[model samples]
Target chain A: MNLNATLLGELIAFVVFVLFCMKYVWPPLNGAIEARQKKIEDGLAASDEAEKELERVRKEAAVELNEAKSQAAEIIEQAKKRAALIVDEETTRGQQEREKIIAQGHSEIDSERNRVKEELRTQVATLAVVGAEKILEREINQDAHSDIVDKLVAEL
Target chain B: MAAEEVTLSSHIQHHLTNAKMCSTDAGLAFNKACADSGFWTWHVDTLAWSIGLGLLFLWIFRSAAKKSTTGVPGKFQCFIEMIVEFVGDNVRDTYHGKSALIAPLALTIFVWVFLMNLMDLIPVDFLPAFAGFVGETAFGMDSHDVYMKIVPTTDINMTAALALGVFFLMIGYSIKMKGIGGFIAELTLHPFSTKNKIGMIFLIPFNLLLETIALVAKPFSLALRLFGNLYAGELIFILIGAVGLMQLPLHFIWAAFHILVIVLQAFVFMMLTIVYLSMASSDNH
Candidate 1:
């Protein structure tokens, strides 16, 4: 109920406590709060950067896959063209070999026919001479007729 | 019957008195031996408990600050940060002036004042009765002489001291914002004035008188508001205790309601101090 020197003591205590609080307590805690805010902001930014990087890699992979697929298609196309050309060349070479074999066979057959015809002609001539000799021997005595037959054979 | 009435009145008186110490012409004195006009009187109980509570607040905050991290906070750090942020937010909202002192000062007043007011919730007779028993047994002093008022905010001196501190800060801010000349002029000008030189000159005294009362009332209201609320609550607690065994329920109910008053008064004190400083810092005139 009365004013006394206790107020002075309390006043001193209040000022000292406030000064101490301002110096010690407030700054570090505020620093920690601000630091945490910065840390969270940085974390979010890094995550966003990583997400962008992932998207870029995914796009690159898709492009490379398309390139590889097109290259494979081109190789298959070249192989098909080479196989078709080889088949065409083989067919042409086979046609030429068949023609040459046919020509040789025809030439051999012609030669054989000519040799048989010549042999047959020779045999016919010999047979005709013999018959004429038999006739001459029976009809007119043999010597003069034989001479004629030999001459005929020579002519044939 | 008269003797019982006297005893009851004395019980109420005993709860109201502080454990006082003061200087005398011979040497030192306590309580009744101190003079009525003893300006040197010290309320030892109020001083001890209030300062002790203030230190406890500092120690806890310091430890919390030490353990605080930029990462996930533990429960203790979380609770401490909540209170600090609460005061910081209030200061930021109420105080437009850019000074480092306001937030921490607000925190100090709020926590320190709240702690002092919290002492009212302790059973009214518990500490004083223990103090009396100890005094009678340990010291050879009469138990009647042991007056221990534990709730510091209930004492006018303690609240007045806090309010006076805020009052000084207000004046300092007003002076700093509007220099010495501007401060004096501000006190003695406007709120009423005239373009006429003679009329303005006549208005100066009236303005000074009105503004001075307004300025002085800040601290006066601040001190009495907290002291009156706590003192009334304490007196009622004391009165209820006189109801014998039934005091427990009534005491609980009153204390439950008083908790609101205790917290609200501390908040109001802090808010008013910030608002006053903000007003001082701004040169609206």
Candidate 2:
């Protein structure tokens, strides 16, 4: 081969081949690589986003749980207060009712004792008038003697 | 025309005349004569040898593929695996970021180019002469037209093709990594910039010119590096072949030296590809 021709041919061929390879082969190869890299980056981004969301949700849930717990505690406290109030009211009401019943029972017992004593006094006066009549064994007018005996009984 | 009647000096003259017809500055005349002489040509036989080499590579690798082991690999498999790993590692080291295509592309390039370069190890005249014989007997074609150069990497077309592939990849990766605006900015403002209005005025044109030159130089460098190595190796082989058959020791020595050339050329090609891709992927101007 002539050196010059060979060199020239080589140069020309080289230029053409370089152009062709750049046009056809390199793009897809590089694109495939870039695409894979992009996919990895996207995956990482998505994961990061998900993690952030998870953190936010976790915080929100925790706050909600705490709020719920606090509210529940408040409700329990309120219930306890209400129960104490009810017990206090009920105890006061029960004591007042018991006092009223006991006072009524005492008044009833005093009235019954007064009636029995009055009845005993009346029976004793009648017996005393009868005994005087039996023990004297003397004839007496019913009107005059009765008046005197009544006067004596009144005095006694 | 009678063989016995022709004097030795006259025979020499006749041969000289015939040789003269085959000589030209462009060597087109010689190429044509060689094509017409029914002995040696370039295209058809070179293509056939390329196909044959491709087939040989396929066959060898096919058998080797069957022997591939999961645990302790056989010699051939290990060798192939090592080559794959080496190419992979080179791609990983040179091209930053996640490269799905660059790695495999680099691997294929290494193996394919290496196989192509290995074709030079075959006796230069063997396949061509064999093709010549086949052309004369089986095909009944001119044997001279059957000239074949087996090593494709030695062909400027092949190397240029590889370089061009890299060039396009560089452009693509640059665009993807830098965006259109950024790419333009790199061209217009890189290596110098308008930090001050006075500096900007002076630096703008200069930077643009420099950047333009750099852009042009990129593909040229890639192309020349591959072509230079391959062409020089081809030239050495041709020179060795020209020194007559008696210089067997010298031929062997040259061939041994060419082994390094073959490997180095492939490596350079692969390395340049990675470099170009890396540059493309980089945000830095």
Candidate 3:
């Protein structure tokens, strides 16, 4: 129990050990713990951001799908309308062309019939003139009787 | 005749004596030879065990501290970390001051003192008997002359040294936080102050006496409490050893109980030191 050099030795040892612990031990361990805490927090925050982004992208995709579906339907409707209008226009043009062709054939037929009738009348007039010459025993002059022949043909 | 005849009293006395070494007029001396040596004498057993245990504390802690990581810890790492965290939490709870030294100082005291106290659990005669055998055979010295008190905390020199260190720190912190004038005023003022200036003049001496005794008693109690606890534990073990084969049950019972004292005393020493330093740094008074 007597005071001695052992006390001095222990005192020196205690101070040295405390200083060693203070300098080397405390800070690094505390730093590692804090750094790990920050890392975990950052990881959690990033996961949250990813979840929000996923929700946003999902919403955008749904909207685009709806828009594209409507756009396709509108295009199909326009094409159907255009096809119907083209069919109507072609039908009207075909009907007008068929009527005009039938009219032209009738005009050509009338022209042909008139030409034949004129020939027949000329023949009949000639024959009538020959018979009259034979009956009266004298000839008829063509140049002086043209107006009478045209009137006789017209009457026939 | 057996060259070594052991008596009941001498057996206990030998277990209690430290292996002392000091300079004498004739030259170098040890143990019984250093009996008349004064303050300069060294208790080699106490110095050896205390420093050895202190080094052990540092070595283990240093390795763990060196390899510590933020990732998953190994078993050894976790064990050391638990101790560090336990002491750190106690310091944070008890110590209100901002000094970086308090926590580490607390850690050192708890671990170091506990390690030294752990020596008490060893069979009482084991190390000393072995040391005496080595002395008798190797160095050709009488077996009884070679003493080894394995537990350092049982030695007053060891406990007093630690308490005195805390004592110095307490004073230093008091002076640092409250200047010398303030420290002096704190000692010589209040607890007996009055509105009367003449009354204040009369009260300073009484106040100084009370405060000085109170201040010095802090370290004295700290040292003696640890010393008394461990010394009594060691003495009981020695007495139990004298009972020969029948000592087994008694030793186990006492050792089991002493374990609580070992840890509690170390904890008490650490907590008191933090509180004292906390008070020293505080100006609340």
True contacts kept of each: 0.80, 0.02, 0.79
Candidate 3 lDDT, tens digit per residue, B66-136? 88887787898889888888888899898876878998899999999999999999999899999999998
lDDT for B56 (candidate 1): 97
List runs of model 2 lying over 4 Å from the truth: A1-156, B1-70, B197-205
TM-score of chain B of each: 0.96, 0.75, 0.98
| Ranking of predictions according to lDDT | 3, 1, 2
What level of docking quality does candidate 3 show? acceptable
**lDDT for position B134 in model 1:** 91
Candidate 1 lDDT by residue in tens digits, B237-274? 99998899899899999999999998999999999989
Q: List where candidate 3 sits over 4 angstroms from the true fold.
A: A41-156, B1-4
The segments of candidate 1 whose C-alpha lies over 4 angstroms from its true place after superposition are A45-156, B1-6, B35-37
- DockQ winner between 1 and 2, please give it: 1
User: How much is A29 displaced in model 1, in angstroms?
Assistant: 1.7
RMSD of each: 7.7, 15.2, 7.4
The digit string of per-residue lDDT tens for model 3 on A89-117 reads 99999999999999999999999999999
lDDT accuracy of residue A115 in candidate 1: 89
Per TM-score, the best of the predicted structures is 1
**Candidate 2, B1-285: lDDT as tens digits:** 332464545433322121112333466454345534332223432333444544454445445555554445567765755665677679878888986567655755565677778877776656656765786789775665444566766555455556666676777787798888877777777798757878876777888899888876776776677657766766566556556775587778978998898788778777877887898789876
